[model samples]
Target: MVSGTGPETVPEAEFRSYYGHPVIKRPIWHVPHMPLYLYLGGLSGASSLTAVLAGLTGRHRLARAARITAALGASTGSAFLIAELGRPARFLNMLRVFKPTSPMSVGSWILAAQGGLSAAAAVSDVTGILPAVGDAAALATVVTGPLTATYTAVLVADTAVPAWHAGYRELPFLFAGSALASAGAAGMLATPRAEAGPARAVALLGAAVETAAATLLEQRLGLVGEPYRQGRAGLLLRVARALTAGGGLLTLLAGRSRVATAASGLALTAGALCTRFGVLEAGRASAADPKYTVVPQRERVETAGPASVPGR
Candidate 1:
């Protein structure tokens, strides 16, 4: 009879912090470099995958172009990543130890492997140097390609960024779809229209997947998703959505004319770039707002009890 309240009826304890500062560290990645690296990595990965698929299906020219695209993208993306580190000499330190628990380490290894394979494949195509070896190298990318397309999602989600972590499940799919669209756009741009049929199909499918994942991410993320629809991030995502949708629609008629194909390809490529920038902006916005960090933590405590509360 001494009880003041039942367990289920207990009032939620108010959560407070030191002047509403973010409880977690914000990402230290610089603008343009990190986001651009993500976009390029995705494009490289998907291009490698597409190259392998095209080669298997007897589209030699398209496959050659895709291999070169993958090589160029991966090489350029690695340069961006190295620049982000701020010290080219320190790049080797990233490979000192393999830690399965470290997404960065995993990604570094994947990038290294991808760069080598893609370069080898591209060179082989250009010089007819070790043709079978080049083909095998291209095929090897089939394994690393999907990982490259998706691991960046895990990298971002593993961080404390509220928007990124909250959308972890959808982020991988989003990035994968974007990667496909990017690679497809490159393929369509570089190859003859007659040989671009698979590229068109891939682009459309990718656009659909990307659009669906983005919509779901925005809808299901609740307050955490707000950053995606406000200010610069919002503008970028909105534009990306429109471009992706429009580009996908245009893909149906792209095979009919070079102008249509080029237009659709350009739209999809721009849209993919916008998506990466928008996602990065959203993460930055979430980190900038203390509420995004505090509120979600408070909710977890309320639902699971204080013992389960994460240490700030």
Candidate 2:
């Protein structure tokens, strides 16, 4: 309200949806190529957990490498995301006001803490390379690994995107599972046969979670889930399912041979990437259609509308 300006007068009334176009604002470039960050961060965190498990079980070399790589990846991926945000400085605004309802805010804090802990843990391992710091880093990862593996689904679910918003109940489970699988993959590659037991467990659990989530997402979404079941989204889903399954199977046999471990690691990594990309694509497609938007709103209105009177 400017003091010199005349009383603010309302203009002609118009009823229009925001960004009325069903399509999103950007071209294919807007596509989330870096959705790998989510995958990487989760994988990194899970790998750290695997490292911890391996360490507890007396797998020193495997645990050290896993912890180091996981922390590095988490740190790198987090940096990429912060750089990508429109207002990186506003990132701190995330902490200014806490809102569990906002996944972005929650994820920001999670990532921040994860980065510090992962770095500390990974760096601490350099006792051979930097003995003093290695000790402290290992201890810090104990707190960060689990949060890193789990918070990404919350980030996706907090959005207004139809696909993500509706699938809130299952996305965290899906992401966590995927993270576990990914971590297992890396562990299989880096760990000795005797030490990779926990990696196998994580992979199996991850595959189970991913498969269950995919089944539920496809079944429960009705029409809105179409994006995931068709087109590029469909392709991505297929690859994710296949890779996750293959990876899990490979993990089971990881103790037998190095080839299986390598295959499992690669497959799990591929599956994680496919899942992340597919999710982003599905959200884009869901937002791109007027029918999906209009029909749902109309259905809601009709169901809630006032009843008509026969006489009136």
Candidate 3:
């Protein structure tokens, strides 16, 4: 019999990267600008949708408020984006070509289109010069608005960032819901409580969707999702959830009191902004950490076995 040492246990491998550097480069997008653009883009998109719905339902006051909000959000968001790019021409340059495969290209086009449409709608509403043209512009936004709101999710997810790529499925839903909540809040704040019933309903629905999507994203991502639960990202997200949930509940009671409507609107707006910031922070954290990148690649290699790995 061979003198035998029973099979020895293998030591678990510790994650490391070349010189402790991150495997992937961190995002170049700046703070406040990127997150704020995200919030405003979503707000513009959802507000446009809300405006159309309100107009169709004959809620002129609510529709007018939403239209103005959408225009302002788009214009302001574009300015932030331009600032991030460091030149006004860079913003215009993006519109020079449209690439179907590129999220950035598509998003740029959508932003431009949405901005123009919303602005026209707002101007027409305010000036009362061309009702037909304004109505057409507002109707046009229904197509571009949702695209504007959700395209940023696609943009980030297309990157190699583990947390963002992993949560791709949920990100759109989260963004969409946040957008709706933002627009609803804006509508409620700008319009009287009596005319804000639809806005309240939209806010509640949006809050529910946002909360559910965020929960599912954290639960489904396993290790990749850790960034969202740890550090600054985690803190912001937690606050976002609390404020959004609280604001949603308050929206239920807003019908009876103007104070309640204002409170709910403000809370939901703040919550939506927090969510955008939290998501951006999570992406940065995940990209900065080598473990998030290495572990997932290692897991895939192990699952495929040494024989199946490339160059084996």
Better of 2 and 3 by TM-score: 3
lDDT per residue, candidate 3, 1-312, as tens digits?
233766667788877678988899999999989999999999999999999989988899999999999999999999999999999999888889999999999999999999999999999999998999999999999999999999999999999999999999999999999999999999999988777777887888899999999999999999999999999999999999999999999998665788988898999999999999999999999999899998898899999886756785
Candidate 3: worst-modelled 10 consecutive residues by lDDT = 1-10
List where candidate 3 sits over 4 angstroms from the true fold.
Answer: 1-13, 308-312
Of 2 and 3, the candidate ahead on lDDT is 3
Query: lDDT scores for all predictions?
Result: 0.91, 0.76, 0.94
Q: Which parts of model 2 are misplaced by more than 4 Å?
A: 1-20, 23-29, 86-101, 128-143, 304-312
Residue 106 CA error for candidate 2 (Å)? 2.3
lDDT of 2 by residue, 1-312 (tens): 435767777686543456675434322323453587778888887887777787777878778778877877787777667666655676777778777777677777777777776677676676466645655566566677777777777766666677776788888888888888887777777777677777777778878888888889888877778888989988999889998888877777666788877888899889988998888888777777655555666788899998888999
Per model, state how many residue pairs clash: 0, 4, 0
Candidate RMSDs in Å, in order, are 5.6, 10.3, 3.1
Q: Between prediction 1 and prediction 3, which has the larger lDDT?
A: 3
Winning model by TM-score: 3
lDDT of 1 by residue, 51-95 (tens): 988887889999999999999999999999999999876677888
| Ordering by lDDT | 3, 1, 2
